[model samples]
Each structure stands twice: as C-alpha cells, then as structure tokens.
Target: MLNRKIATSTAAVALLLTWSAGLTPAHAAPSSPAPTAAGWLARQLVDGERLETVVDQVPYPDQGATADAVLAFAAAGVAQDNATKATDWLARPQTLAAYLGDGTTESYAGAHAKLALVAQVQGRDPRSFGGVDLISRLTALQAPSGRFSDKSAYGDYSNGITQSLAVIALERHGTAPEAAVDYLVDAACQDGGFPLYLEQTPCASDADTTGYAAQALLASGRQAEAARALEWLEGVQGPGGGFRGSGPTPQENANSTGLAAQALRVGGRTAAADKAVAFLKSLQVGCGDAARAGAIAYDATGFDQGNATRATTQGITGIVGVGLLELSAHGEATAPASDCPITTTTTTTTTTAVPATTTTAGTSTSSEPAAAAPVTSNGTRQLARTGFEPGPALALGVLLIATGVLALLLARPRRAER
Candidate 1:
C-alpha cells in the first residue's frame, strides 16, 4: 500500500492505473456530514478499552475482535482516542497471552499471530508485545509439517486462517519458516483453490480460505502455487466483480471479496485485481446517515447490519490494494483517485408502498409504513412511498439511503456468539 517505496516504473504505472479505480461512485454521492465508515468500528469497545463480546449479559475480552479494531483504525489513518485506547489496551503487559487465552474454543495460535501482526502494524515490537514474545510462542506451535496450531481440545481450531495469519505474522519479523510455507503451498485442492480444513485431498475450494492461503503462499515465495489459487479465484468471480464465499451457497460478501482482491493484486493480475477492488468500492457507503460514510459493507446491501464494522474495516484494506497481512506493516497506501471502482449494482433495502388501499372502515388509508421511503436507482424518488413524504436522495442519487450508523451499532458480532 505504501506506493512511495516502490521504485520501478512498472509498479508506478500499475499504481497509476488502479489508484482511483472505483472511488468516484463514493466520492460523487453526496450526503450530510456524518460518521466516517471507520468511525463505526471505533465505537464498538465495551470494557477495559479492549474489545469484548456479550455472552448471557457477561462481557468477555476477545482477541480477534480487538485485533480487528486495531486494523480498522490503521487502515483509515485514524489516530484518535479510541484507536489509541485500543492500542494501549493491547500493549498492557499482563494482557499478552490472556488476550489469546481462549484455548478451549478459539484458535489460540491464530490469536497470537493476529496480535503479532497488529503490533507490527502499530509500529510495536512483536517479539515483546504485552511482555510476551509472540514470535517465539507462535514458532513453538508449528508442527513437524510446518502447519501452525494450538491443537485446541474443545473444537476445530486449525484452518487456513490459523496457518495464513501465522505465515504473515512471522514474515513481518523475517521469522517465517520455509516448512510452514510448504504446509500452505501443498494444501491446494484439485480445483486450484484452498479449503479451510485440509481434511482430505481434492477438497472443495473456498473464497475466504483460498484468499488467505493464496496470500500465505505468495508471502512464502511460492508464486506458482499462489498463482494457481489466484486463477481459481478468477474462475469464481461473480458478475458484479466480487468473489463468492465458499460452499454450495457461494454468496459474495465484503470479507471474501476483500481478501481475493488483495490476493489478485499481489499475484500480478492487474485487471482482475481492479475489478475486485471495484466491486468492493461499489459497496462502500458514500454517505447517507451521519456516520456511515467511507464504510464498506458485506455486499451490495451497503453496510450489512451484521457486518458493517468488520466488513468495512477489512474492505478498506482491499480498496487500498493491501491484504490484511500487509496492513500489519507501517505505511500509507498510495493510489490515484481514478482507479476506484464505481458500483453498478445497487441492492434495494425497500420497495415502494402500494399506492393506497380502501380501509375496511370504508375510508382511505392514511398511514404509511414506518420504514423510510423507498428510493429509486438514481437515488431519487419516482414518488415518495406516500404523497406527504419527501425523498432521502443524496446529490449522487444513491439508489437508497439505507446506510446509517445505527446499522453498525446493531451489527457488531459478539465474540460470545462464536
């Protein structure tokens, strides 16, 4: 993402071509001053200034959620109080292993890797973060086959997420093991994509797993393997330019597309990368509610009520051409404005109300639905849902004004739920 460091003309030319690929749609759409998309993520802190998930009215600190909060802040260049608070919480000496202590259920190994990456991105030392030498801790967990795992006893913990994060985290400190690299490189399925669980050969390919594994393979200097995985991603790209999630349902969401976009760009598939980036940009909330601007949603649903915070955080990195691992490094992502993608597909949150129905009392119906009026493609109104209502249209004519900060508040996924 730090373009100023790349000296080659080819790299510079590529940056030029994709810098503004899909940002215009967001920029052109106008709404009142509101909370930036990144702002939505900052508000999720519960107790101890650390991230927490509610479980039966009890609050438990979550490493993954906290790590996500840090990445969200870093991606947006936000250096505000909340970001500092989260960083400070992470830096506490006693919190090191405790943050990743959910060995019974969570991937404790993966937590170490994610926090190590987070520390590095924040310009801290991964070796001694929270008074814990995570690099060493993670290294000790690597199996003879180079795959990383805590081998948690309660539930499945080892997966592409665990391996990929470990690979990337170790890479930042120049401690990545070659054997570990091979573990991911050789885990490729027959279809060229990677699966979350390496249960057997010829496994099904998944977007999230494949995306992370492709990144892991690329970081490990196994470009051939990474290329094959990337090729599989291209094969599954949706018509709207986003990549689909794994499994039979195969829905494309911000998380899947963001990872694939990063992998594609890193793999040297410029056009494909641009398209994926565009797809993500198209989902960004230009501005509608006061606090949802600059946030990316899961898909065309623009700020999914369940994914607004996590999705927007991850999506910002993709739009900047940096994968989650790369986000761990300290630098600004440089890009041209023209390279940003504009969204062509708009997901409607509401449809127009029927004109009116005669009341059972033999009088004209007087009440309109409590929901906001339905918006049209141009973000204008063919007619307000009712004759008395005014449309909520941004100057860009955003197809609808469904995005708002409240959506983010309601969308935060609690760690307890997992």
Candidate 2:
C-alpha cells in the first residue's frame, strides 16, 4: 500500500509538469503567406500619422507655420502633381529648413528626413524637395573620423542612426553613396554590432544600432557587410525569439525584433528573416489599442513603434524598408505623377528707415518705400488627413502588455528561505 501511494504521487507530479510545459506560450508562428511590401506598408502607417500628430501637439514658436507647410506639402503630394506639391513645399522651405540650419542636431535632421520621405513617396524629384540640402547638412554633421556626431562636439560619436538616415538621403539624391557606406563601416565596432554612439566607455552593441547599420549597408549596395551584421544580431536573440535593447533589460522587445528581422531580410538571410517574421507576427497588436490603431506596437511600451515619435518612426522605417509591415489602408490613394515640372520664381525685398539719432546735423532725413512683396501660391493642403482606427491599437496593446508581463515574471528571482 505504501509503495502504491508513493507511485501515484510521483505520477501526478509528472503529469502536472508535462501539462505546464505544453501550456507555455509558443513562438509566434508566421502568418499566412509572407507579407508583401505593400501589405507591410499598409500595416506601418501609424508612424507617419503619429509623427504628424505629435509634432502638432508640440509648442514650438514656429509650430503653426511649419505644421501648415508640412501638411500642405503632404496633402499636395497626394492630391496634385508631385512637381506642384514639391514647388509648394519648396516655396516655404525656409520654414522647415530653419530646423536644418547651423547648430541643428539629430532630431532636426531626422524630422527633415521624414518629411523628405513623404515627398519621395508622393513622387517629387529628390533634388527639388530639399533632399540636396539635407545631404549637405548631414555631410557636415559627419566628423572627420567618419562618425556622425551626437552633437557638434566630437566626443560623442554614435553614428549608426544618423548614418542610416544619411544613407537614405544620399540614395535619394543619387549621390554620396560611397561616403554614406564609408560612414557606416567606420561606425561598426569589433563585435560586428554598433553602439548608440562611439564613446570610450564599454557598452554592448545593441539591436537598434545594429538594425540601423544593417539597413544603411543594404541601401548602399553592400549586402555582404549587412549580412555580417545580421549574423552578429543572431547572437543577441533572447529565449523567445525577441531582442533586448541592451544588457539591463532582457525582455523580448517587439520593435527591436521587428527591426532586426527587417535588417536580416534586407541582408538576404532567409533563415533569420523567417525567425524575425515569426517574432513580429506574434507581437502584432489588434486595431483598437490606445496608442496606435492598426499598427505594430514598438515593444511592451503599449505605444505603436512607427508613429510620429522619433524612436518609433525609425523602427517603423526599418521594418517598412525590410517589407515586414504596412501603412494604414484608409488614406486617399492617388496615382504617381507622370511628369515632373521645373518652375522657378524669384523676388527681391528692401526696406529703409531714418536714423533715430542725429549724430550728423548736416545729414538729410531720407524715406524709402518697401520693395514689392513676393507673390506665392497658397500651395496644397490635405483635404482630409488619415486617422487611426481603434481596433488595431487595442490588439497591439494587448500583445505588448502580455509579453512585457511575461518577460518581467521570467526575469524575477525566487525567494530563498532559511
């Protein structure tokens, strides 16, 4: 009888263990046939809308004018001919260009790049849409050592993200591909990964930095280098096929994994690409989530990765470039322009004022009328901007929260008692 009771207890314990193992969350299986670029694009539209919405909320002194101009350009690109839209944006380019002027930083460059991309998609000539100016600014930002700067100071050299954007801009203009490639190569660390910036301090190469580097290399036609970077990334994948931002947090991050998958795909590594695709599919939030509707959540942040927020936008771009996500489906779809026109107009303005003080008693007071004001078009504005639906955001939020909680629980330590 005693032997039989012991056997029964052991059997029950074994059965429970087996059931628990089977109940563990499985890796996200790939959804259907692989998602196409257009499909992925449709999934990733939140980043663009989010960007516009965030910028709209900020209280910059020039916010109104800049927003007006950007929205106009974006709307015109969809409604009017690409050239006409480009002309409208370029006419008031100074509004946004001010952000790119001297003492400008990464955020400015990134904002302009995002705007440029919108113009690109709208079929504007890269040169006419301020792409050339952006290239010049980014080039100047590059240090002599080939690293992009965190600021004007050469001390902080985290060139991966900046270099990635520069590569996009360079490719757009059909110039400086070699320079962009060289910048990416120089920023690479010994471990085949990249750091946020180049510092003397010891820091592990990160998924975000590596993802940007991989994308840049791929864009510049250096598939081999991009492939090597992807190999390095494979080493960093966590237990459940998600990626960590760095050492402190081992959580499986949706955004990082999505971006990593994109890089791998673009680098031409099908095996890793498949894993990344699976991971992203698992993290997809449904359309009703709070932060973003109908888009992939960035991580457990409950925020859509690609919307107007800076980090999210970069992540979205990476994913989109790799063909894993798509933009929203509701926006107006216009045909690409057949012809790009060249239109130029110039105006001169002058003002004269009498001296407030009479240092010279003999000097005569002179009055002059202001020169003729420049004539300009009202430019294109969005008849209706796209809005996010609730279902996608809710679904993405649910996934993000669930995964984040799981990661936290897994990371927790069990108590030891005396």
Candidate 3:
C-alpha cells in the first residue's frame, strides 16, 4: 500500500511539472519575435492611443515616442488596430499644434518630418494632415545649405537627425531635391559616418545618427554615401554585435543596436545585420515574467520599466529587421511567446497491485485483484487549461514539487515509527 501511494504521488509531481512546462501565457499564444515585441509596445500606449510623459507631476502625451511606436508597429507588421489609434491621436488638432507647433511662432523640423513620415506610413496624406501641409512645412524649414533648420524662438536645434528625417520624408513624398541629398552627403565624417550634430568641431560619428543617415541616403539614391555610412557602422560595431551612441565612454545599448540593425539590413549588409539582431535579442526580457515578456531591455543591466518604452519602441524596429523607410502595418494580432528554452520532463508510473482480501463473519476470503488506476504523464491540464496564464502556474508547480518531497519525508518518518 505504501509503495503504491509513493508511486501515485511521484507520478502526480511529474504531472505538475509537465503541465507547468507546457503552460502558455494567455496573451503569448506562440508568435515570432517581431509580432511579440510589437504587441508589448501596443500595450504600453496610454488607452491604446498614445504614449505619455509626466512633467512637473502632470502627465502629457509624448508625440515623439508615440510616433516611434507607430514606426515600430509598422516595422513589425503587427498591431494595426492600435497603430491606427495612435496615428489618429497624432492627427488630432491639439496634438498636432503641440507637437508640430502653432506654425506661427515655432515649427520643429524633426517633428514635421517625423510626423510626415508617420502619415506616409499610415497611408494618410502628409500634404493635408491635421489641416497642415506637413511636407510643405517641413520643406519650409530647409536652409540654403540644404540643412533643415527648426523655426523656433528658442533656437535652431537641428542636426544630422533632422536632415535625415527631412530627406527621408521628402524622398518618400517623391519631392526630395538634389540639394537636400547633397547636403546630407557633405555632412559625413572622414570616417564615412555621420555625426549627431553636424558642423560640430571634430565631427565625431554617432551610431544612431549614422543609422538614420544611412537609411535616408539610401532612400535618396545616394548609394555611395549610404555604402560608406554602412561600412563605418560595421567597423564600429562592438564585439558582441551592439553599437553605442556618440560619446567618449559610450556603452552598447539596445536603442543604438536596434537602429544600426535596421540600417545594416536595409543597406544589404546581411552578416552585420544578423549579428545586430542577435545583440538586440540578448537585451530582450524573456519568459520569466509574462507582463514584461518580449520587451527589449535598454542594456545589460536589465529590463528597466522607466526607460522600457523608448528602448522597446526603438529596439523593436531592429528585431523586426526593417528600417523606417520600409515600415508598414500588415500583421496579425497574435502576441508572441519569448524564445525560452524548453525543459522536457518525463514521468514514470509504477503500479503495485496486491490481491484484494475480504474479512466477514470472522472468516478471511480472497477475491479478484482490483484494477489499476490510469496514470498518464501527458495530461491535458495546463495553466492555459485553467483559463489563466499569469505567474501562478510556475508558483503552483514549485509548490506541488515541495508538497511531494514533504510527503516522501513524512512517509519515511511514519515507516520508521512503525
């Protein structure tokens, strides 16, 4: 009897572990990395519409991050419904006024170009979005040197990024001028990479700026400049396949790696792109936590909730293997499961049958043996079977194992007493 009890209990423990291993998170119904990252990003939006930033204890919509989310969504080709909501929010009058400026006192070159790109991605009219001709406004910021300057009372604050965005937006609109393309070409450093702030002394090349600049140059048909920038990016790639922003002591980060990955892929550097993707994947938070699953961490430290939005938004583009120039939304809504290692669990059942004996009227009589209960390790029960897929299944699995061990210990103690 004791042996039979032990066998049954051991089988139960194995069943628990197998169930836990097979348990799939409700939201993560098996998907690729791109869709999974995109889905996580979609959930980060405020009310499924926009991303927000808190300032002075007040929350305000962050248009730039929101635009980035849209771009990420397009790049991954998923979450089109949420992407539509975000794009709608960007097209709102007040949102446009705040982000793109009032058009009378302050108009930002980057903002204008970025939103124009967003509009184009969503198949909306950048010419008349939010009652503003985004293309015209963006073009109006261009200077004689072909650099797109910001029209603001505070300062010009434009740089390589602004020029890149302006060129991409104009190129996509089929109105990219030769001067604009030439200006971006001339901004390249001697090392064949672009700087974050053009005309800055020493012209230090930046990973992020070079990433965007390469894509822009490619879009404008500046193949030579684009090739040089791609080569520079490859040369500067870290040993672990990551990239760093421009700084004396720059650390490899997911944001920079993501941007660089997109550039390398689009620039036809297949080997470099593959390595970049691997680096980005290393920074992704995996299956341990369902809520943060598929989220790309900023760096090696870990998944940071505070900076996750930006990191994830930018990181997703690279993971999806696409740049902004080719981003589009045409994927399904299925959230992806992280590529977690699977541990195959096996269970063995030992059935000990003892013949049934009956005692009646002070006389003992032997009867036929009882049938063995069915024991199958491959039970269909799982966390998903329980209609929940949070963290409970893992905890419960641990508890079950502990209980089984405790049972074994208690059984041994009782046998000794006997």
List the candidates' TM-scores in order: 0.66, 0.51, 0.75
Error of 3 at 359 (Å): 28
TM-score of 3: 0.75
Give residue 401's error in model 2 in angstroms. 39
Where does candidate 3 stray beyond 4 Å?
1-31, 55-57, 333-346, 351-418
lDDT of 3 by residue, 1-418 (tens): 4655555555455545544444434332213666667777888889989998877778888999999998888888778888889999999999999998888689999999999999999889999997899998888888888889888999988899899988988988896878888999999999999998889889889999999999999998889889999999999999879998766528888899999998999999999998888777666655445666677777766666667788888888887777677776666554343443343333323322222422111212222111010111121112211224554667476767757684765457556437
RMSD of each: 20.3, 27.2, 11.6
Better of 1 and 3 by TM-score: 3
Task: Give all candidates' CA lDDT scores.
Answer: 0.61, 0.45, 0.76
- lDDT value, candidate 1, whole model: 0.61
Regions more than 4 Å wrong, model 2: 1-99, 102-121, 130-132, 150-158, 175-180, 247-250, 287-293, 301-418
lDDT of 3 at 211: 94
Which segments of model 1 are wrong by more than 4 Å? 1-35, 46-60, 93-98, 102-107, 247-249, 324-418
Q: Tell me how many residue pairs clash in candidate 3.
A: 0
lDDT of 1 by residue, 164-250 (tens): 888988888895899988888777788899888776665878888888888877787788888899899999988767888766536
